[model samples]
Target chain A: MKNLRLKAARASLDLSQQALADAVGVSRQTINAIEKGDYNPTIRLCVSICKVLGRSLDELFWEDD
Target chain B: MDWLVRISGVVALVCIGVMVYLIVKMSPDGFRKEQYDERQTLERLKAARAGFYAMLIVALIYLIVTSFAPELGNQSRVWMCVMLFFGIGTFCLYAIFSDAFFSLRQKPWLYLLLIGVNLLTQGFNLVNYFADGGTLRDSVGTNYILVLGMILLLLIIGAALVIKMILDRTERD
Candidate 1:
C-alpha cells in the first residue's frame, strides 16, 4: 500500500498539490491522502494521476515487497 | 446591496407581524376540545416533521449554491442568496407544510395548527406590505400569492374534515 513512488513522481513534475489534484479530477485532500499512503485511490483515479504526471503505472504506483 | 438589506427588512417585519398575530388573535376555539386533545400527539409530531423537512430542503439548496460561489471568489453574493433563500424558504416551508390541512390524520388539532400557520404567514405579508406603506409597492404578488395559498389550504382542510366525519360515522356503525 506504500506510495512513496507516487510522492516522488509528483515532486519531480514541478506541479503543485492542487494542480495535480485538479488534473486528476480529485480533491487536493485526496491527493494528499494518496501521497501519504493513507488512502487507496480508485483504478480510474490512479490511471488519471499517471496520465497527468506522464508516468507509467509501475513508476507511480507499486506495493512494497 | 441596498436591495438585499431592504428585502431582509421587509421579511423580518412580516415575520414579526405573524408572530404578533399568532400570539394575540390566533385561537383554536372554533373546533371541539375533545377532538383537539385526542390528536395532540399526532399534530405535534407532524408539525415538527414538516418543519424539519422544509428546513432540510433550504439547507440542501444553500449547500449547492455556496459550493459554486467559493470557486469564483464571489462568496459575498453567494452568502447573501443562500442566507435569504433559507430565510424565506424556511418561512414558506413552515407556512405551506406545517398546516394540519395536509395531515393524514384529519384530527382537530391539525386544523388548529393549520389555521395558526395560515394566519401567521398571511399576517407576515400584511405587515410587510403596510408597515412600509404603499410607497414600497413590492408586495403585491406576495399578497395575492398568500391569499390564494390560504384559500387552497382551507379547501384542503375542509376536505379532510369531511373525510374524518365520514370515517367517524362508519366506525360508529
Candidate 2:
C-alpha cells in the first residue's frame, strides 16, 4: 500500500521526506507514515502533500492496477 | 520530620508550576500550530479517553482497598491522592511516548529542568531521613511518597522526550 509514486516524485525533486514535511508544515514522521500507508491522512493533508511535490492528487494518492 | 514535609511541599509546588506553565504555553495558537498537529491532537484525545477509564478503575480499587482495611483509616486521603496521580500520570505518559506531547518542536528542556530540581530536593529529603534512621514507609506515611511519585512520573516523561528527540533528529538527518 506504500505510495512508491509519491516517493519517486519526491526523489525527482531532490527533496527528502523531512523537506517535504516541513514544506507542508507536518512532522517528518507524518510524511513517512503517508508513504508507508500506516496512516490515512485527511484530504487537506493529501492536497498539501500533493502541492508540495507538485503532483496531482490522483498521481500521489490514487491506487492503480 | 517537619522540614522533610516542607521540602516535599516545595517540590510538589514546583512540579505543579511547571505543568501549569506548559499547559499555558501549549494553549497559545502559535505554539499549538507549531508543536501540535492533527495527528498529535488525535493521539492526545485517545490518551485522555484511556486516562478517564483508568481513573474510574483506580478510584474503584481504592474504595475497595480502604473498605477492606479498616486499620488504614486516617491514610485514606493520601491513598486517594496516589490513585488520582497514577490515573492522570498514566495518560500523560501515554501521550508523551506516543508523540502527542513533548514532540520535536516542544520545549522539553524547561520541563526537564523543573523535574531535575524536584528530584534534587527529594534527594535532600531522603538524605536527611537516612541521617535520622527513618525507613521508606515512614517517609511515605509522612507524605513524601507524593513527591516521589511525581519525580518518577517526570523521569518517565523526560526519558520519553529524550528518546523522541533522538528519533526525530535521526529521521531528519
Q: Which numbered prediction scores highest in TM-score against the true structure? A: 2
- Report the error of model 1 at residue B56, Å: 19
- Top of the candidates by lDDT: 2
Candidate 1 versus the native: TM-score? 0.29
Tens-place lDDT per residue, model 2, A1-65, is: 88788889998999998798789877777777778787788899999988888889999998888
After superposition, the stretches of candidate 2 with alpha carbons farther than 4 Å from their true spots are: B1-34, B107-114, B129-143, B163-173
The residue-level lDDT of candidate 1 at A55 comes to 89
TM-score, chain A only, candidate 1, equals 0.89
Model 1: TM-score for chain B: 0.34
Candidate 1, residues B69-117, lDDT tens digits: the string is 6553334443434444444444433433323223222445566577667
- What TM-score goes with each of the models? 0.29, 0.71
Return the interface RMSD of the candidates, in order shown, one decimal each: 26.5, 2.5
lDDT of 2 by residue, B1-173 (tens): 99999999999999999998888888755245446666777878898888888878877876777789866645665666666777778788778767676555756778778878887897688667768876545325356666666667677766877887787776562
lDDT of 1 by residue, A1-65 (tens): 55778877888987877688668655454576677676666678788889999988877886647
Question: What's model 1's lDDT at B133?
Answer: 64
Backbone clashes in candidate 2 total 0
